[model samples]
Target: MPRRHRLTPEKHLKHAPWRFTATDKAVLTRLAQYRYLKSLTLQKLTGRPIATVNYSLRKLFDRRLIDKPHRQVEGFNHLNAPDIYEINARGRRWLTEEVPEVTTLSRTHTEGPPKHFAHSVAICDALAEIELEVATAGNAFIPAATILAKATVPNPLKMPCTIEHTFPNGKHERLETFIIPDGVYGVRYPDGRSELVFLEVERCNPRNPQTLFRASLLRKTLSYRALREAETARCLGKKSFGVRFIGLSDR
Candidate 1:
């Protein structure tokens, strides 16, 4: 068997222009939505075979439309971890120019992967799974961008409000907090009914004491309770909405 020569970005630039396919555009769109995604996640989101996803990713990388940071290799277990990719400036421009329907593009990660890369990856995994399940159930999963398009309030996702609590000490306490969800989406059923949902990804760290975790979660719960009481969704142009929490383990 003959060995295949791996082409670098420079070599690809010198070669003849490569045309875009449906799969290629789909991959780019996903990148634009998530900002950072693993190769396997792209496969799941696109519902394509591993070979097809890898080929598309390779071609995109070679053309400098996407970036696979070396920092990913340093952070994860290299033996089995999939490559992480992000859309570069060129890719963003390509999508804006070539795909007119793609109006929303995630902000570029100028500082590289976030401080909590695992948490981000877990969020993407959960989203991919939920999206697939929604499709299987014959429903449409509308992403945050779509939901925000019709929003009346500015920056509704990061909501800020005040909460008042009556403590056991017979005293009234007021706390001001922000309700920032990891993601917001909507599920539309066949009966012309739609439900809005806020997604929060929680990770359990073995190093942190359980008591602290519980306290943190309690605060979040209170914040969400306040949000519901205030009918934040209605303010955001929705009748009602639900909050979903996805728990992840450090292991």
Candidate 2:
């Protein structure tokens, strides 16, 4: 396999100052939304060619507007995975200052890649695929932001519920837990009807013992069940909602 060309500050400076374009702004916006994304993912989200996306990323990196987490270098290089990028303070400031209309929340800036980097990336990939498909179907994809803006409940994403379970000794217990999903989105059909859905990405870990994994799954199932019984969808101004789990392999 051919080696990938590294972008150095010296090489970046040799060219004229990179002017921000629409595509560059789109890349920053996406970084703000996803927090961390792969170079290929950005290409798909921006609907730009890979070369163009790389060019924009390089320029943004040179300007200190975006970052490549050092942790990704070794693992991604070995696997030939696309480079992961994140927005930095400067990038968020640029979005707020230059593109006043763009929303740049404090969460946009991250210290580094998440502990579960692969899992996070999988969630982003699933959301992107769904968004693209919804657009293709001529339906409007309502993102979490819109849902939150219209929600009557505070922090609806992090729902709290009580779970009841029995021990081997036949003792019953009630535990308080939270049902936090990976994401929330809605699909507005052309017929003026909308469907709200919660997303959960589940990845099986071979290292985890089956018993432990099953217990974890059970807790999640119970949490969702509790939420359904409580009619938590009403908090979001909906009578009902659906939970979609995207199962992933350990690979």
Candidate 3:
């Protein structure tokens, strides 16, 4: 398969309202059957170039009518290639209610019946922009962190570090990697600087209320001692990071 493009962060606009076309619905239905199909394969099925396939998928994804499958495959360059397209319960219901012609196959239903599937789709669109932004930033590629800290003083880790937050729940969600937004200026320690000097400017606005709330609860519920102990045992897993919240009034 040809190299598929990675999405950037500017595209994660979940709070926005959008509409999907009939073509978007068709592409999604095809993807729902395969759970993951390459743009080339989609072209063969739809009789178009890989570009059209991606465009349709992007629209469907932006609309939240389909999701990328959670599985990975070996790529041409030995990287983890994405394959399959699985429609979640939300997508199924949307198809049934909004576009009922293709409900032949029964679909499973989840608790939050995705009344805002269209909204989630908008978020996915924003995430594509975010992914593209990160891919191009080239701000000192740092090794994936095993733990989070303010900053590493004395350069103990001896590895390059990046300052950014992360969102882990994309269509093909990856591991605990930071989702560094574009326009976030990063400063690095010179060869002789004592402290690890750095600066950052927030860019992407995170609008997912549930994830933000859950992360906050987790931080408070897990005490310092308990968190440390769990880290020592390698039992506590890292959740995705989000935009840092400064003081703001709920009005």
**TM-scores for the candidates:** 0.81, 0.81, 0.33
Task: Give a tens-digit lDDT track for model 3, residues 28-113.
Answer: 66544333355545555555666767776766565556665322222232135433344666677777776655522112234343
Find the candidate with the highest lDDT and give its number: 2
Question: In model 3, where is the ten-residue run with the lowest total lDDT?
Answer: 177-186
Cα lDDT, model 1, residue 140: 93
Candidate 1 clash pair list:
none
lDDT of 2 by residue, 181-247 (tens): 8878899999999999888778763322233223365677677888989988788878788888777
Candidates in order have lDDT scores of 0.73, 0.75, 0.37
Summing lDDT over every window of 10 consecutive residues in candidate 1, give the lowest-scoring window. Answer: 205-214
lDDT (Cα, 0-100) at 30 in candidate 1: 88
lDDT of 1 by residue, 22-65 (tens): 88998999888777788888898888899999999888887888
Ranked candidates, highest lDDT first:
2, 1, 3
